[model samples]
Target chain A: EAGVTQFPSHSVIEKGQTVTLRCDPISGHDNLYWYRRVMGKEIKFLLHFVKESKQDESGMPNNRFLAERTGGTYSTLKVQPAELEDSGVYFCASSQPGRGSPLHFGNGTRLTVT
Target chain B: GESVGLHLPTLSVQEGDNSIINCAYSNSASDYFIWYKQESGKGPQFIIDIRSNMDKRQGQRVTVLLNKTVKHLSLQIAATQPGDSAVYFCAEKGISSASKIIFGSGTRLSIRP
Candidate 1:
C-alpha cells in the first residue's frame, strides 16, 4: 500500500565526498530504477534492478557511481569522490514489471555538492 | 542518446481553460508513452499513458494523444487549475518490454488564475 520511499530528502556534501542514497520500493515489487536529473536537464536513467540482480546498468555515468540491491529488497546508490557534475536530484522508482503497472516514485534525494 | 523532446519548453494557460503540451520522440520503436507531473522538490507522478496502437486515451482530467507517424505525443488538461502548475514531462518507454521510461526535457506549465 505504501509507495516507494527514499531517505534524506535533501543532502549537502562537499566535493570529493562520498554519499549514499537509499530507496525502498513497494512491497512485492521486483523492479527498481534509479534516475538523475541535473538542473535544466532531462531525467536520465542511471540503472535498474530486478530483485537482487542488476538488470541494466548501462546508464551509469562513470565508475564513481555504484548501485546495489542486495537480498532482493531495497536498493542503494553510492557516489564516491563526488564531483560538481554529480550534483543533481537522485530519484528512485519502482514498478510491478507488468505491462502498465505505472512506476511509483519517491520524493527524490536532492544531493547538492558544494 | 535518444532525444524525446518537447515542442515548447514552457506553456502558460489561464485557469478554467484547457492546456495542451506537446512532445516529439525520436525512437520510432518506442511503443509506450507516458506523461508525468512533477511539482517542485518532488519526483515525477504519472498522469496518463498511451500505447502505440491507440491514437487517444483519456483519464480523469487528462488526455494523451499519440501520433506514431510523426512520433509526436501530446497531453491535454481540461479545466486547467493553478494546482496543476508544475513541470510536465513526456516519457517514452523503450521497446525492451522492461518498460524503461526515458524522460523528455519537460515543460513547465504555468496556470494564470
Candidate 2:
C-alpha cells in the first residue's frame, strides 16, 4: 500500500499571496490529520478529519488558514494572504479508524513566503 | 498547557555504539506514546510505539521505554549506524480521539564514523 502523498513538494509565494496544499492519504483510511513545523520548532497539530466531518480543529492558527476534507477521501489546506510566518513545512498523515494504528505520513509540502 | 519535550536538542554517538534519547511530557493522562524518525526533506516515519499499559516495547534494533511515574519516555537504538542518523521525535496521544497527537521538539541523532 502506498503511503500518504502530498503535492507540490516545495512552494514559494509572496507575502500577501494565497497557497493551497493537498494531501492524499492511504486507501481505506478514515482518519486524516494536518500538522506543521515552523523553523526550529516541534511539529504541531493543526486539525483532524474523521471521514467528511472535522474531528478537531482547535490547533488552527488563525482565520486566514482553512482546511477541508470533502467526502472524506482527500484533504486540502488553504492559506489566504500568507504571511512570512507561514513559511514552514506542512505535513499530512492518516491512520485507520480504530486506535493503535500508527499514523502514516507524507513527505510534506514546504511553503516559503517572502 | 500540555507539552512534550526532549532532554537534548542534539546527540552525537560513535558508530556501532548505543544511543538513548529522552523525552519528558507534562500530561500524565496521556495513554499512548510513539517514536518517529524524520530524515531531511521528509515526513516522520513511525519507529516504535508503547502504550501506557506496558513499560517497555522493543522492535528490531529499537526500543521504547515509558515511565509513567515521572512522565518520562526514552528510545534506545542498538548498534547505531550512519543510516540511523535523523531527528527522532517522541509523541503522545491525548486523552480522546479529538485530542491531536502532541510531538516533542525532537532530538537530532548524529552518528560519527
Best by lDDT: 2
- Model 2 chain A — which ten-residue stretch has the worst lDDT? A95-104
Across A14-114, the per-residue lDDT of candidate 1 in tens digits comes to: 99999999999999999999999998689999998889988889899999999999998999999998999998999999998775667789999999999
**Candidate 2 residue lDDT tens string, B14-91:** 999999999999998898899999999999999999989999999999999999999999999999999999999999
| B1-113 per-residue lDDT for model 1 (tens digits) | 57799988899999999999999999988888899999998889989988888999999989999988888999999999999999999998876756578899999999997
The alpha-carbon lDDT assigned to residue B13 of candidate 1 equals: 98
DockQ of 2: 0.76
> Model 1: runs farther than 4 Å from truth?
none
Residue-by-residue lDDT tens digits, candidate 2, A1-114:
889999989999999999999999999999999999999689999999999898999999999999999999999999998999999999999999766778999999999999
DockQ of each: 0.69, 0.76
Lowest-scoring 10 consecutive residues by lDDT in candidate 1 chain B? B92-101
- Candidate 2, residue A69: the lDDT equals 92
Candidate 2 recovers a fraction of native contacts equal to 0.69
My TM-score estimates for the predictions, one after another, are 0.97, 0.98
